[model samples]
Target: MNTTPAQLPHALVMIRPRSFGSNPQTIGSNTYQQTDEGLAEEEMNEQARKEYDDMVAALKKADITVLSFDDRTDPVCPDAIFPNNWFSTHPDGTLALYPMMAKNRRTERRQDIVDYLEAHYELKQVVNFAPFEKGSRFLEGTGSMVFDHTHGIAYACRSPRTQQEVFYKACETLGYKGILFEARDEGGRLIYHTNVMMWIGSNIAALCLEAIPEKQRNEVLTSLEASGREILLLTQKQVNSFAGNMLEVSDPEGSPHVVMSAAAWASLDSKQQELIKSQAHPLPLSLDHIEKYSGGSARCMMAGIHLPLKPGATP
Candidate 1:
């Protein structure tokens, strides 16, 4: 049997947003969001599509499997390009669906995608956490919590989008240890997503330690050290540039590739770049329009597909 590494997935699921733009509903907590006054809505959508296509092509060219889906037009999900927030797959055949902070984003959890995955993969259990939204508790999949699958740890920052109780419940459900912390951006607003401030790869962990409170930094630092990962410290400015928002994927030959935005790559200094290069090949995509409108980068656009394939299923 062929198996993928726990920390790195060889396949990803991505959604191409047709009506892609900055989501007004998410603007309150997502300080990183900004609208492009220069481009009209149609132009913005066209640019986003182009960027999305280019990213998918690049990932596929690198020998990583990409399952692409088109976004629905009826409800008009502006932030649909970032599908990582809706659901996550596991090697244990557990498909976890999360409760979203934005009502519009909640609609991104389409039944067709779930059905397709179940047909192609070994989906043993479907753990739906969407019910928690009724109580006003939210946990937006990978956006709310970043999982260190190799160590069974889920690193999360507490915010309106990431509730404490719900995050622990997800950890318990996935059989992971929940390492909850508080992180704030430069303006002292709570970081919207854990993935926006930190990224944990197989052998490397990149994070903006300054975003985390002084008293709470040691736990995250100690945990990363204990996990045997080399830490690449990021500045708050870099985090704002989406430096912390990266995903480490593996090719068919099990070689690592760090997928990030051009802005994110430019934010890194020589030392940080070298450290990342030492661990994985840097694959930066230019997502200028998407980043400006959606406030998400390459990492947020991909949902890693970690489920084992069913009999005779192609990756």
Candidate 2:
């Protein structure tokens, strides 16, 4: 029932201006357009890079510690923005590498990023689940499993991208328990990403409870209540604006900030705004082109690296 680590005192986020055609995992969503109006791969990449640069500048202005990295040619990897899906950093300085669903996405797991992180932060262990890919079983990291780090509980929406066995194994590896649920959109389609439907903050959690089936709604509600989290429920319309896909981060001065896309913020009602501001300052950046083409908002672009606090210091 704990809820502190979920509020990131420090985080590592990525920006994608050249985000198009990068995430092969979204092929099921038909994320790509077949019409000529669709951007060429090169053009999309260029635009994505530019958007990413702009986003980084905005975060820097807020004094957020950002570890930025450009896509490299070493492996021709795609869908790198969802780095949280490929790997997760733990408070104990351990790293967990997940098994990706898409063939192209498997290539996105780069050792170089891990090497860089190790140099800057303390790294104790590296637990990899990529071998599951050999058996065709997948469990995309935060995209599939949402960890309540403070309580050591992992909540995951059932989907093709999230296998139940893999989910259990991940929890076991992390010394946590798993709470599996089924979440569907208004159209009754399974939500593609866990972050799209629910986001856990320090004292608050933004979720689209309407997406849960009647049979499972109470279970989800009970879990949230049990965790001592204040809920900020969103409607179907808000979910479309990426409302639930938000991350609570901190500035270099250690002040809490809620990060989301401008589009998501625009969809919020005054009440929702008040509820969010009660917890942290709102930070909304323009990711129109990036979101329109990538179908991932601000939260998807970030990978929170919860390294241990330094000696005699506050994180």
Candidate 3:
């Protein structure tokens, strides 16, 4: 395997859901979300938990450090498993909390997670964008924007959950140049999250160019070209299978691995799989139950830990 780049984090933070199900607040915007008519709510929750455990196990087996936490029931959050939306950590010792569109999702943010990070990592600063929620403006963490930290570029598509003004402000705060564009689904609806249609790694980027408008598509292509990344074009059908919702991470030894769902893996053609394998090792986790109901895949479940470790802190 090749040496891992700065864009690939060595550790991840994942929340195991106790009451996982379809979120009513997010279903409207999230066109990818679907309901399993056969399963009861309780059965769905059990399946989600099992899928979560299986995913964590697969990740750990690949030598990735996973900081796992259980969801709280005090204020029930059905979409709590998708932790990448709430907050993000940076290599510059910065922790940022984002403004969520759904009222129920706002409760996913936990003080304990912040405290634990501060205790173990070198957290130099904390930036909160949650105040924007009061004005009904939102810019979800990694969900709304995909950061190519290696090149200091933030790629985002215009959507209800991703306000342009807030996105630009976030880019300015993080010292990144923002690349904003319009991407719509097949039915002419805006894709809720940018991550669902694109994923950027060290040298490779998978994107669904078909979803983007012709006029604004060139800008995205130009930016990726300027970064010298090899682009992999994905069809809308493949994207619906969660093909673009992939994350590149690394093990402690700096071996790069592309974490994705089994469905995503199956969606890829043989040639595409070969190209991906040449870039990094593919680690596919079975998440049919979780992906079918919640509308998110492997990338959404993991919040990458980019902060540096503190003195004497164990990995």
Candidate 4:
């Protein structure tokens, strides 16, 4: 990655949910992607499109450029809408492809998508971990870990989708310090992804204290504080509402903004809202239908494009 000051990206890549719905393969771990037998497939797709359009419009209105891609339907990548789980780009023009735990989710990784991105931006390196899928060990990109890029710190909660060995290898390759721990929800099941429990920005962090074990909570807190970051504590209920699934991006004007789903934004109290607002503008998008079946919110829908632009390419 780039050895420069850490900041939110000015561009984002969002995949349209062409074939969106709950996946039986992921239902065991993604508690949020609950299927509704009553809703017709046509109606569900319409609702999903409306939500996706609204979110894209909102992000663009905030002066954040969006590179939108339509999800393919051939084999039906159900969770294709949540693109951040497959790959992530860095400031130094490094692109990392992660190994997904879900058999179906692995299909979400497409070479054409990366080629389309490269057509507009300049990426210096490609870190491929998809080969590790043969061993069954996985690291679901940013979905499995919340990165504090500025401090080179990675906060991840161990789960079926996030293995420690894979996590450490990725961190080691990226030169980040890994802080691994177990985090459980109210039902005592492990939270599938850390982004749903912890979110780290340039100098701010939002985390669910209840998710982390009591013994390990202090260590996480200390690490954040030592990194010179202000904390916004979230409750388990809030985390369930996707409160911790927020992403920070920059407007074309160069101002920082925090983006989240309306459901996630609504879960926060006035105090918590005020604290976050002090750092960046909150772009609360309406994505009710998408969140209902995809098990991901605004952050997961957006894969920030931080790679340096190729010659003659606009930012």
Instruction: Give the winner by lDDT.
Output: 3
lDDT of 1 by residue, 137-205 (tens): 999999999998898899999999999999999999899999999999999999999999999998999
Displacement of residue 201 (Cα, Å) in model 1 is: 0.7
Q: What is the TM-score of each candidate against the true structure?
A: 0.98, 0.91, 0.97, 0.96
Prediction 3 TM-score vs. true: 0.97
TM-score of 4: 0.96
User: Which 10-residue window of candidate 2 scores lowest in summed lDDT?
Assistant: 29-38
Q: Model 2, stretches more than 4 Å misplaced? A: 1-6, 13-19, 22-25, 29-37, 309-315
RMSD of each: 1.1, 3.2, 1.7, 2.0
**With candidate 3 superimposed using the best TM-score fit, by how many Å does residue 261's alpha carbon deviate from the native?**
0.6
Candidates in order have lDDT scores of 0.91, 0.77, 0.92, 0.86
Candidate 3 structure quality by residue, lDDT tens digits, 169-233: 99999899999998888899999999999999887998999999999999999898888889999
Candidate 4 stretches greater than 4 Å from native: 1-5
Which of 1 and 4 is ahead in TM-score? 1
Give the alpha carbon lDDT tens digit for every residue of 1-315 in model 4.
Answer: 222236576688888888787778888888877875678878888898899998898888887889888988776888898889999888767899999988888999989978877887887778998888999999999899888877778889998899999999999998889999999988999999999888887768889988888999999999999988799999999988999899988776667889998999999999999988888898998888878877888899888877877777774
Q: Which residue pairs of candidate 4 clash? A: 2-92
